[model samples]
Target: MWSRALRSNLKLSKSEACIFFKNKIRGASTCVEGEPEGPVVKTDIPGPKSKQLLQELGSLQQVGTIQLFANYDKSIGNYLVDADDNILLDTYTQISSLPLGYNHPELLKVFNDQHNMKCLINRPALGVFPGEDWPKRLNGILSEISPKLPNITTMMCGSCSNENAFKNIFIAYQRKKRGDVDFSEEEKSSCVLNQPPGAPKLSIMSFKNAFHGRTLGSLSTTHSKYIHKIDIPSFDWPIATFPQYKYPLEDNQRENEEQDKKCLSEVEELFEKYEKKGIPVAGIIVEPIQSEGGDNEASPQFFQQLQKIAKKNNAYLLIDEVQTGGGCTGKFWCHEHFNLETPPDIVTFSKKMQLGGYFHTAEMTPRQPARVFNTWMGDPGKLIILQTVLRVIKEQKLLDNVLHTGTLLKIGLLELEKEFCYLLNSTRGRGTFLAVNATDSKLRDEILTKLKAKGIQSGGCGSNSVRLRPALIFQEHHANIFLDKFRQVLKEIN
Candidate 1:
């Protein structure tokens, strides 16, 4: 019945419906017209061509992270084509960066406009000199996707966005303390020398398993992995514990509530501890769902209480939505699901948004010019692409599609968890940004390898969780493909 409904909604014929269900549908769907019927594996993932290219590129640079060389030109929606002509269903979607997927027709045609072409060719130092249309473009974007924050400061990428957002928060924190007073001479001179009163020992509190960024300041707050911080001189900042809830949350409500209380208590203690140490926390940065650290999630009640705590301490809350934004979570932002009493002080974004930046409250906007300035603050070309992406998202009601497909996917995963009992568990997440855990990291890696061999390109996070970061256009059929492939992988492992 559901399959029939899907066919009716998508307007697929009998043969087309069969292919869609069987995970083989050649260019027949309207949503992603040129997308392949399903993944086609012609060779081993790092096939002959990719291996040779990796060897060639390895000579000039460290290529440890290069998994496989891709042929973007041949790639289509929900599918990535490798240099060896193997087509794989790309659930990770370039680490959750691709919004509409590879070679999206609308995105490809965006540069066809002479104005957009000029925006790409004549990139300006946006801080110093912006085109006349820059303000108009920004206004359109703000109107369409501002998260209710009035001000936005665009930047280069996720790292810099978080880095600069920390600065903004610190500036606001100090400005509130200064109370319209001009900077004193000592503050100016001391800051020049990186001393007290100028470069005050302010800090941004982050969670234990958080992955904000790798810039000098943001790196100090990042605690996900040792390699990201090894040998780097980091500030002495307070690290709070993020809530670690047990799986099947409904069945573990009391335990999860206690976990939230425990984590929140840690946060309050750290606030006081930092205050007493003379290095007050200016802000708290967190991911709605800790993407890189793990697909760890906290309850909406936890976020509401955390926001209240931030208000009580006068420290701003900065939600890092770099990976969880852009309608993947069945909403424009994952934090929206939390329904906080008030909006976060700053909401940093990038990933699917094309350009990186933060939506900040009026107070968070620095009073002094150039306080958070940078050359080429953001690219107009990227904004042009983003505008099209947003349009497509709304026109197709992709958010609704995400919710529907996510329900089916999650249900399928839960069933698999029951069937594969020992091998899989802890299925969690919203929309298509879902994840399931294996027994251990080794088994997780093995599962991912087997899935990829079956032409499903997925990713792992934290230690043993397989995360799904499919494009927003991912539909019911796509979810079926992944579930089918995943079930096969589990069977093999068993």
Candidate 2:
């Protein structure tokens, strides 16, 4: 019965699907032709199925953060269906990871090709034994979404992407130290014992409230939440301040500039202090727009200046775009907005890109093999999905949609801020990678809860920010629904 309904919901007719790639922009109707006109809240948020499943799952493992269980098959287009069958306009988009909403027809058909099916089932140990078409698959990703960086090292997830990028940076730094000399036996021997010279006391500079990932090495750089980092011992690396720009940025121009200056100065000071203290900073990893940290954005000048600083300090700069990349900011890589003199030493990505990897310069390439090696470097199946996703993005002109849709969402947010000045503030972000701060953390969570009840799924970042991370295919009509629902929720909150 659901399949019958789902079939009707999928605007999978060849004509409707092909409407965008050829003629003028056709909007999201072509993407999910039979998608719901608006969200349908069938139950009270977590409803019955969600609560029951949560309880059942809770008995097995930790499910503290499990807000609701999703019925992925039933989910379509921009809507997510919870276990209770309540449909939500999923602005959160599986933590900003889903490029297209659930079950895009093009993607669903990918496995129809036997070769693609074989690739899906026969997962290879990519590092040791990649399939014949691996290089082509990799090159496809590069050609389609290259950050202008020369090489890429694929890994398992966002954490490992940054983790291995850190290794690459360290290896490069060490190679520079080695110059023409070969590694001494003592260096090798001491490294085995986790001692100096080989396993040197190097550090990566990260920002306060920045979230790179949760793996040990990457976790050290993640300062978004105490919950993610507490209990586990972490590296004592430098944590510089990310600029907290005042909202109504036009009104706070001078102050924001000063904020950037102060933050940059501290970054410089950290480099000097760390260098003198013996634990030299090998790399600097920062998110383009700190998503989990509350959608904090810095000036292009700040990034440009930071890049220069990385060069000055002989440290590699890594732009962590796990959340901000994949055309969310109307660019393939969010760092493109910075307009740096040259590409940064490395750019790490995952989440929405279908795989975790870092696009890097040749200098960062480890001379030694297995330094960044793992059993399965990255899933080939994901590459297949990614290739299709990239094609759809190009054919449908999702970037253009993002730019236009983002403009509408931003304008609406500004208007809402005006009307609910006391309840909301600090409206900012790029594209649909947007967020707004409520009066306090309680209010922020309340806004998310209310939004969910209203059949819109929003996420909260920082202490008081309600983040909007709609899918790439999200259009003006979706934005209107979100804006309307948001206004309704705000009125009720007031």
Candidate 3:
């Protein structure tokens, strides 16, 4: 069914089909090396030059978490060169943000074009004074991606995109309940003091181990780390469990389905409980893959059912695609694979999109202006880059590359899991956005650290999972390098 849908949607004729099949069989992308010929390590990662800059930056603000300073000019394609001239294969790609790796000629062309300079220099308060080309740019985005949501609200980043999306949902929820009625004087006056009746008690339901963002409104929905929330006050929003699967997935299919049912039940119950508490949930926010919390995945059935629960309770559904957007997942939007009954009410995206914001349903658009206003709602300069990035993805067919490369990664990891059975398990993810869990947190950290020392940069999430957030240009050759380094580390540990 999925393949048929893909074929139907793709609509390839005989010649197109022949080329795609030929590429698939030959692994055409694997033949093209995107990374530099060799990674060079001239000095320790944070050697002298980076340490000096860290000290200077530390004098201004806290710089404890600073890594080696990068020489962006020297970095090319998938390899990152540090200030000390240590070139490492970068898999994290600036927290999974860079779409085309470093210094792609197409992206560089943007800087060379003088006409785009005006939008970059004279930035406007987009809500009130959008540039003349704003609508045209937005039209391009809508036509290209859209995610089945006809409306859009551009914001500044992941958190604010989700934050403002929540506001849009809340306003639509309220407006549906109170049609043709003006705001009462008492309601307007009381809202100034942040009390109920005027402010109205409403909530957004999020799942356990989710990381929405650090901003106040988004923080209320982020449940991953206590450090991000300990000192800050937050809303008493309903938190449901995201399904935890036992691997190998085929062996644990029945158990995983049961886990899905158990979680979906809790979601329905929470909606009722919150309503009884006088703060009904106005929307549901979730990550397609629970990234940051450890690349946790749920069955497509789980997401489909969860959407039904949201609709049943009249809560808008918002998929937080902050970390999963772009072509890393072999699709422009990861949710495209789910075959959702309908498009989500809102899909918030950032990181690789080059701009942060959301595609939402027309119903979610606010009736009044300034309800979702912000200075520089989104940057036009970023949109210019995004437009270019979209062109590169299509012209190069990067999504096909992701699919081929991802299979190489998944198969290699499965083989590693079999060999290193005692140390790791639960290797999972869609496309190149993959991960494997260590037996324990300490072991996970140790393996990650060792991989870094071996000239491969990786990232960790949750307690025991090592995540792969490679650039869209990550070819199978890069995957083989990572797996080779990874196997060496595992062998040494054993």
Candidate 4:
């Protein structure tokens, strides 16, 4: 029954199903079609066919977090379709990774280009033998979005980008400590055995609820959930408290300022303690807005002071924009909102950029090349896609759209909080990267489940916060549609 309903929803033909790229990709004429007329739901979410497919997938792997199987071919614009044919207005956008939503025309056009096809089919080992055009491609893309930093290093994803960035910090720190001398024979031999004088006891400082990644070095800095770190061996790195601001920010300015002071003080104390213990902190890493840790935010003053603290303690600073970058926060780089006196020593990104890498000042560039190297540093195919995405962003002025829509979302969430005071509070965010807290975890889960059934898919973060990570193309009309459905859900729960 659900399958039949789903077929009706798509209204597609056999040839259309085989090519599947019709209507979405346009010709030499480049005008984009506006947003579709809201979402269309053909069946209940996770209808019978979806349940059977999920059971089959579960037998093959640990499919615990699987929500509904996606019909990638059918999903387009801002709407998502599941195997059961239920269509949802997707606000989560694949854990905040889909930049232009699904199947944007410009992205689809890459398949027709012969050069892009060659790059995709023949992956190169970037460290040893890159294609001749590799350097030119790197310069063009990296320079365009190079934050305030001058150099760029590419990697596979968020985890490895940060893990290698951590290594870059350690290498720079050790090089500074050694001054002009060559490594001692003892130091060289000891390093081979993973010991001191070579391996070193340096560390990276992270905030209490921050998340860098899940690899060994990056995992040491990730503190969002214990389950991610349970059995993995980690370093004894320092973790400072990130400021917990109060709601209706205008009403709690003084208290929020006090919160900032208390957290900054704790960070200083940890730096001193770690130094005294001989495990000097080589770097400090943090998210512009703590997305995984409940969307916690800090004032620009807090980040400015934090950078000063790092400089005073002779530690490098790395800003992880894996989840916050690519204009979700109304700026190309979210940290740009902080108005820091200088760019951070390193800024790492992945997610929506279509690749993972870090930007750094010339001083932070590794003295050795292969020391910070990887296979296929990042795929050329992803760069081709990023080029198209970047073009669309500029031509369409998507950043302006983000701001226009974000205000609507923020205001709506605030009004909802007032209407459902007992159930929610503390709405916060920049641009469309917004979130609000329920009184507790159980209520938060209920809100999320009901929102999905209503055809609006939201995601939760930290403990009790529902985060909004809409695509850059999200507009005022889409925001209104979401607001209306969300209000209806709140009414039912009340």
Candidate 5:
């Protein structure tokens, strides 16, 4: 049925056809041919080889976060091959960046095309000397994947995208105030000196526990972990509480609704407080779902109201979809689920999108060039890869795949939460971007360690949540493997 549907809806290339037919069996053990049938833990996770590699790498720089050294050549599909030859089913998906898993055939063939190889090798300072096809390329790709916003500014990564986006927000804000006028001499000179009227005392309000990025500007807004911010000077911008709801949402509707109200009320208060402090908020930035902060989710109504608050305060709403975009939440962008009255003023994305950038309204476009730019505003090479990723996603109906696989994964998690009530709870999130809370941070770490030992490489978030960030290609069979392993771990703990 899947193969017939693919054939009828679109013409598959010889390679694509092979991929589909190879995995067409009703209960196939693996999706990618030559991929492992199941994980093989030849040794402990960071077994001898990985430890030796880590020791060697530690000499160059800080390796505190090094887990295991991967042998990319051996990895395929959802399995990660470590230096020790241990094959682990990877649910974290390279911190949720690998859209198609390791070395997908289509992606590998991308550079085989001479034009693409040229794009990759002959890197240009895109800001000044872009290829003639750059505009056409952007239009073609953005036409397929962009949010409702009409303008876009390509960037390098999540942090750089968010950092540059702050410039756009501030520029637009001041432009509105100084409508149709050229900058005065004082404004120009003051800006160079980092003073008022030019580099204004405007602010971008962010939510507590939000992770925008780690760059200086974006870092000020990031509050996920203190280690990422300790001793670093930050702006005193307003910080509002994000909605925290009790789980099994149907059971605690009233309390959750009240929680939404409390958060929204706090947002309003902060806007007023910041205005009184003379650093009026120029914009409000938030994550659709706080991925790094325990996969925290907010109600659709909460977001709808939040958007209204931003508009009322004459501030732009920037939905930082760095972790929630690119179909992870069953929709291409997670905010699509909110049903807002209007599109957000800015929607920043990275990770699965292949490159960093923001979709924004025309109002956010700077009056002058170089106002929001860098040497390589963005890599044409990444766009080439993204072109293929988007094509595969559409041609393969991967968004629908995400919806189906996510249902299986979330249902299994909910069931586990019930069975291991003392050890687990709060199974939450949309699509494959789900998470579940353990008894505490300590137990959460233990659960992750045990799962890793059992050949399931998952990840944790916030204080105690296990986050699932599987690739879009992840299917029901993969979900079953994870659930079976997770159940085993929970049973052993119980």
Candidate 6:
């Protein structure tokens, strides 16, 4: 029934069919072989069924931010099906985490093995009593994508991964400072009271408009929004200005270079200011691309210089790949594009990787057994899925697919910006990690709402930017559908 509806709704001209839909799988994308050809907007977005489900969920817990309830069973590939049966092309891909899209047969077969099932059910306190296979499994993860780091400290989510990473940075910093000396009685006692020289005033310098995480330690470095940290107590850390580049990078080369210099100078100044104020910066936690805060990007030079700044201050550089990792930006890690002098001191990840964890250098290794410990450090179940995810990513050459699709997506956005100059601009990003700024915040929200009505699920960041986070499986055909719909919507609004 869905396939029939799709065929009728997407019966295109010969040229259009050749460009978009081909020999696609039934009920999948019209253009792709196994996904829906086009989005289906049968009812008003967040239609009655979704509204009813949301109300039910709200009664049980907070659902104030719930826009619509998904019918997970019906969702597939690059499309999400809401409870009302509205099928929307999901460019944001659950905020850029769904790697292979919903129910990719490869992932579903992961638990088919009885051994895999056993591992999933028999949870372990990995910090203390890891399973026999734990060593090999972790090694496999590290070997494939460790950012040249030697060790892994697994945690629960992006927030905790970063929180524990903060602890690791502090411990390593103090270890270097104290020169392997045992803690003095006064030092121990002062720590209990959370005083200086024990608790210490070390800070992690972060960029303005950067989002690390929401845990107490990570939240201290997050500068994205007020809602996430409004009532929460935060650390008084140095907030360096991030580069705010002008659009058409080539056209504004001089201006953008100035922007980078201005931001980099502020960082240099903050380091001096923090030191003089007696709160030494022990580390810097940053997203290569400032996601959530905005789809703001920096030049390769910016990252290269940022690394130098950290090294000069003897600070650990933690690249928070929680959002930008897992092949979204065409690389196994987004920071790989920077061509840094050395791998970052630490790299944190979660989201598409299926679990939260930090990979760090041997220097960052904790001397004490339980210093960065947690019960059930991370779910083995998530590992099982991750193992499969990694395998599928390799077998299907998904990283290459991302690079291909990302270029197509960025080009479409650039072309759309040209036609709708008043409404869109600043089409920028690496790989599929792309975005365009709307005229204003109000128009941004309106565009997002109308896109959903036309069966496109996009997200907003910074204040006025529309971000695109299509899955790795997203192909040129998918880009064409998106561009066509985008053009239609721009015409509607313009």
Better lDDT candidate (5, 6): 5
Each model's lDDT: 0.90, 0.87, 0.87, 0.85, 0.89, 0.85
CA deviation > 4 Å runs, candidate 3:
1-21, 24-35
Which residue pairs clash in candidate 2? none
lDDT of 3 at 86: 83
Candidate 5 lDDT over 76-112, as tens digits, reads: 9899999999999999999999888998888999999
- Check candidate 6 and list the clashing pairs: 21-31, 24-33, 25-33, 28-35, 28-36, 29-35, 29-36, 29-37, 30-36, 30-37
lDDT of 3 by residue, 93-185 (tens): 999999888888788889677769888998889988999999999999999988988888888899999999989998999888888588889
* Positional deviation of residue 107's Cα in model 4 after best superposition, in angstroms: 0.6
Where does candidate 5 stray beyond 4 Å? Answer: 1-31
- What does candidate 1 score on TM? 0.94
Number of the top candidate by lDDT?
1
The sequence of per-residue lDDT tens digits that candidate 2 reaches over residues 385-470 is: 98989999998888877766776688799899999999999888876788999999998888889888899998998889999888
lDDT of 6 by residue, 1-494 (tens): 65444334332234433323332322222222356777999998789998888888888999888888898898988889988889999998887888888878877788899888888888888988888888999999999888999999888999999999999999999999999989878888898899967888889999999998888989999999999999999889999999988888868889999989998889889889999999999998889999998888889899999899889989999999999999988788999988999999999999998899989999999887888988989988898899888888898767766765665677688889999999998888877888899999999998998888889998989999999888888877777888888888889988
Which one wins by lDDT: 1 or 3?
1
| lDDT score for residue 144 of model 6 | 87
In model 3, which residue pairs have backbone atoms overlapping below 3 Å?
none
lDDT of 1 at 76: 92
Model 3: residue 163 alpha-carbon error in angstroms: 0.9
Q: Residue by residue across 432-472, what tens digits does model 1's lDDT show?
A: 88999999999999999999999999999999999999998
> What's model 3's lDDT at 438?
97
Task: Score every model by TM-score.
Answer: 0.94, 0.94, 0.94, 0.92, 0.94, 0.93
RMSD of 3: 3.7
Count backbone clashes in candidate 6.
10
Report the lDDT of model 2 for residue 315. Answer: 93
